[model samples]
Target: MLAPSEVSPRSLHAVSPMSSPPSELTPRALVAGGLIGSVLAVTNVYMGLKTGFWESGCVLSSLLAFGGLSALARRGAPLSPLETNLSQTTAVSVGAMPASAGLLGAVPALTFLGTQPPGWAVALWGVGLGTLGVLFAFSLRRRLLEEEALPFPTGAATAELISTLHSTGSAYAARARGLWVSGLASVVLTWLRDARGLVPAASLLPSTVRVGGIGADGLLLGIGWNPMLLGIGVLVGPQAGLSILLGSLVAWVGLAPGLVRGGLVQGADFASLSSWLLWPGVGLMAGAAATSLVSQVRALPAALGDLRRLGEHGEGWESTAGQWASRAVFAAILLTLGMAWFAFHLSPLYFLLALVLAFPLCAVCARATGQSDIAPISPVGQLSQGGFGMVAPGQPGLNVAAAAVVSGAASHTSASLWSLQSGRLLGASASRQLFVQLSGLLLGAAVAVPTYFLLVSVHGLGSQALPVPTGLQFKAVAELTSHGLNGMPPSSTLATGLAFTLGVLLSVGARGKLARWLPSAAAMGIGFVVPAYYAVTLCLGALVAVVVGRLRPSATQTVQSAGAGLIVGESLLGVLIAALLALGFLQPPG
Candidate 1:
């Protein structure tokens, strides 16, 4: 029996007070929750295509899904932490997956399949990759959750949103209204700017905007003033986001123009520059992962010890339902993997190699990121599929790519489970959370797959066709495949390296005085790898965050909610407009 002090409801204002946890969600509530989850998922996916990790958008989506669910649950039945976790997990998964669309993995799948892979293939891949990710993440959750107390800043934000909405009904209503209004307005402006290609008056601002520079067809490249993104820049603060912006300006505005003027680079030069950005991004991710793993090594023994204790407790952590669900998802994934292999006629040995490599890689990466719960099994999926470009050479098809997808999905599943386990520790019911999570996974996968196809068919992939501003995606791939680090102009690389070293020193040295600048290491590292434009954008976001935080002394939760609302609203609207353009419901302005 849990102690009353441990589990009883305290004051309503208490962050995690146990007032029946928020009531079990009603059927109506579930449907609404799912729909909201779907929207959030879609929006985040779209944003993810722009920013690696989908960042604040997905975080916000999770918050909204949880907050809305909690609010509705008050009227009917209260939801357990398990249920809430499941819903949030599913929604997050949906958004994350779609972001991977049209990348190397999805591209091969589409090119080879000539259409979307069968439902079974997608399901199998999804389940396999998700599960593997979760398992890998499980190994590290104790370390990340307990020892480090890594502020899952986003998760904390979600919890606070739920608490606030529940405690003050009037405030909740007002915020919701504001969100909708802002969202709608953003949607309209995005559609006009992106789909219709309207030349806004802001474009005429000589200092703030530039119009008609050279682009693909010798047509003038039109640039418009983006106050929203600029506002986001302000919120992200001057440090990180501004750094990214400076990098972007240097690459796109400074270097690109210089090259063009000198006749040293041309249309094709853009591709080469993109390659430069990508490798740095890859290196940064790898380094970050490596660093995280090294930091958490001490906690490994304790985590493993917990597993031993769990075993001694006669599988106390295991629920029959959870086991069954896990098995079912696993079986489904296996069957799909088999079918995909059969369809592609892949070498069984290669397929097995890819499948086997996924788990260890995911586990290692997960441990490193302190996200041991989401062990990143899918990155292996990316690796395997990308490797297939070499393994199969000429045969770029669904068979190889689907294998990677399976690996990715398994990783994702493991991550979700880790998240669920965290909820359990915090006093959530297991069964309810598991069920909601499973439901969410299914729903997210179903919606996201179609959305991926829709987006790619309409917008075309990569920076040239899509509005996703250039970043590490193209840059890293280019560096790995085309130019090695040696390709970086010696002076540029030295400058970046020096800056990076200084960033590290500053971060390490200014522990108390400039704590907020720590994330700038990531920015510097990312800046080194990607174009100056993307670095600038990130810096912009960081700046925006800092300014807003200072200006509004309100709780962090309220500010994050507003920021999240802006991100989701703008991103979703962009997608809808993209879809309309693809369907010929709208046309680009001449």
Candidate 2:
């Protein structure tokens, strides 16, 4: 979720290098990065479970590495920029595990379908997918980073932040301190609201108002109390925030009452409503994703050309990473294939097809990330699911698992390439970065999956506390594909078809001159699945951000830093509360 920075790659390197560059892969750097990355991995899992979004912790990780390394440098050797870059790269890789390892989307979706795999298998599967992404990044490093010189704004910004921090005194410390302070505030707020029960969980709409004779008592409508949703609103900007609010209004206030009055959907809680709502939501998301991919067809020619070049100079590509790296990538491919067969009972042919589809899909994700700073990861997964649905029809497990391979690998590729972009600017060794990133992937999977298990144990999937929006989307798609149109209620089927067409139209409209006028089809679709309270809180946060930006533009970055802190802090605390509940140390509130 790193916003695209306008900073040019060349402009960042204008600053002078260090008098003496440090080692690229020091033991201290590795250990520190592993620790911070592990924390980040946990935070992302918590955040993804709650909100279905995760941030790439590159800038935050860089600041953290600097803070820790600077403290260590006081007694020992001075801090080195290259070493910090490597550490941040490692941390970024590990931090991205929730999305890249399928913990957020695919694995959870399978769990929802009553097919939870063992923790060890999940970890191995994640490592395999993540390593596959690192391989893909290695293959494209020359083309995307060197030959084409894509800006990769996030990477460029990290390089700039590192340079700025090293050159200027007090700036990095101030920013890092601000992050901690913001996080502390979030921690206290979450504890007070969730643990002590001093704060209300939600604010309900006025009961006097009626829509189709369904008032506040008849429909679940309110503004939630989670600071994380507000933080998400701030980070996502007004467009996406408003889009989610729009979707919530359409789904809850508009559609829910009608569905209930017509007896199409039963119950008022999130679970019962989402069971029916997920159909249109998933359809809308898939339609938008397909349209977005189609819009990128122009990149297909250049992509094919890049592939042709890669085929022609395959040896040169191997020379960049060396023969050992090649062998490792092969091992990763084999690991993925083996895990698919052993863990998920996925057919080898289907798994291979997912990988075959992954090549182009990874390119699509990378290009989207590079261009817009928004990797269409969910959409990419939808495309994969759609393909598998066609070939391996009526197999829910195969559909979800195969899409997991594609989405997980693509997510990793996007993250790694951006991290490599920072490395490219700082002149760090590509091979070393690759090695550390691979190590980080394994470390991330080790921590994130278990944390997920702990949360699910306490909160349970589809609960209000852990809606798992992305998981619901994936599960909905798998069910729809396996059962076709005959499986759903007639009204729901009609809604899904209409939502799909609307999604396609909205996505198509966003590509042209009126792009700014359109809402994000994806975020709106997400709003359909999450509670209305979340959307209300998100909109309020977005409004607060807009007011601050207009009143004090200089504080925009400060606000964003705080927003990021709010997300991480509350999520970490939520995880702690979950653990405490699981251990019988904390009781669930009445």
What are the RMSD figures for all models against the true structure? 6.5, 2.7
1-590 in candidate 2: lDDT tens per residue?
22223434444434357554456688888988998898789989988987798988888888888888888889887777877898899998999888877888898899888888888888888999898888777777778877677778888778878878888876675677657888898899888887778777787777787766777744557888888888888888899999988988888878887787778877655677678888888778878988988877888777766555542224553475655655677789899888899987787898889988887888878888777667888888988888888888888888999999889998888899888888877767787898898889889998899999999988888877888999988988887777687678648988888899999999999989878999988889988988888888988888888999899887777777777787888888988988888898878766
Alpha-carbon deviation at 15 in model 2, angstroms: 9.9
Give the per-residue Cα lDDT of candidate 1 at 14.
34
Over 4 Å off, model 2: 1-19, 206-209, 305-322
TM-score: model 2 vs. ground truth: 0.94
Clashing residue pair totals per candidate (backbone < 3 A): 72, 0
Estimate the overall C-alpha local distance difference test score of candidate 1.
Answer: 0.47
Backbone clash pairs in model 2 (N, Cα, C under 3 Å; residues 3+ apart or in different chains), count? 0
RMSD of 1: 6.5
